[model samples]
Target: AVNLAIAFAMQGHENKVGLLDADLHGPCVPTMLGMQDQKLKVGPIGAFPALGPLGVKVVSMAFVLAGKEVPVVWRGPLKMRAIEQFLSEIAWGELDFLLIDLPPGTGDEPLSVLKLLPEMDGVIIVTIPSEVSQNVVGKAITFAKQLNVPVIGIVENMSGFVCPDCGKETHIFMKGGGKKIAQEYSVPFLGSIPLDPRVCEASDMGHPFIMEYSDSPASKAFMIIVKKIKAFISERQS
Candidate 1:
């Protein structure tokens, strides 16, 4: 989701974007952006975010860890503090959009980010087209509403898989769960992303799938979602 947002923002040269990997327990932005070995540099004021493809500024715990194998065994308070610092201390300069990739579920990290960035534009909830995911995502929506944080939309990821050999589409996790949730919750249904092997392969190779596989169905779906997000933002601003 973060990568897709960055790629969409990078489509035009006018927008300045940044991604904050607030999922400290399993920070993957650095790895996904191919900066696993890199470290965040401390400037005079605060730590500097690493530059990524299309000039997207990125900050993640993966950059701070000595290695990928090193585990983040911090407690709740510690995790909250780290999240606070990531928001307050990172040198995120003049960003038009800053996408915070919160850890899954309504957990400590998500709460900390909401508390810290109270004026967040909104959240884009990502879920699979499954009943279990639908139930859990409902809790997320309630949590956001309780905090008075708007939900921009919901994205149903891995909605289906298309066979490369025969070009047949399979509803791997079952379909319409995302839109059903959106309708029940009264939030906008952004779009559904079909499962594509290239998405996984791109992540493994430290590349943005939207950029590398622009012609794929998954990428096309992602772009449609991005357009909806932009429209939401514009509507809010207007």
Candidate 2:
């Protein structure tokens, strides 16, 4: 989800984007964006986010940890305080959009960020096409609605897999769960992203899949969803 958001923000030269990795327990933005070894600089005001590709500023717990194996074993209050600091102390300058990547489920981290950014545009729920994912994602939607945060839409990741040899599309996790959930909840079904192995390869290499494999099915689906997100934002503003 974070990678896709970065790709969407980098689509246009005028788009200034920032990404906050609020998944305190398992922050992956630093590693995925290839800034794991980079540390945040303490300036006059606060910590500055590391510069990423396309000039996307990013902040993650991975940047603060002494080592990759370091663990964050704190209570709810500590976690909430950390999130607050990330929002208030991080030097996130003017941005067209700031995407906060929350840990999955309606947990303390996600709730804290939502409360801190009440005026946030909305949330783009990402889930795989499965009964379990659909069930858990339902709670996510409810959480956002209860907090008065609009749900932008749902993006079904790993919706299906395309065979490399036969060129056949396989329903690896079964299909249509995302759209079904959207319909049942009366929310928008943005689009579906097929399960492409190249996505994993790109992540392991610290490269954005959309940039490396723009011709892949998953990348194509991602751009389609990105368009829907922009349209949704425009409609809301208008």
- Model 2 regions more than 4 Å off: 13-15
After the best TM-score superposition of candidate 1, give how far the Cα of residue 180 lies from its true spot, in angstroms. Answer: 0.5
lDDT of 1 by residue, 1-238 (tens): 5556566665573247888898898888776777777899999999988888788888889888888899999988999999888888988887877888988899999998888788888999999998988879999999999988899999999899888899888998999999999999999999998898888888888888888878888888887887788889889989
For model 1 the TM-score comes to 0.96
Q: Model 1: runs farther than 4 Å from truth?
A: 13-15
* Model 1 error, position 32 (Å): 1.4
Weakest ten-residue segment in model 1 by summed lDDT: 6-15
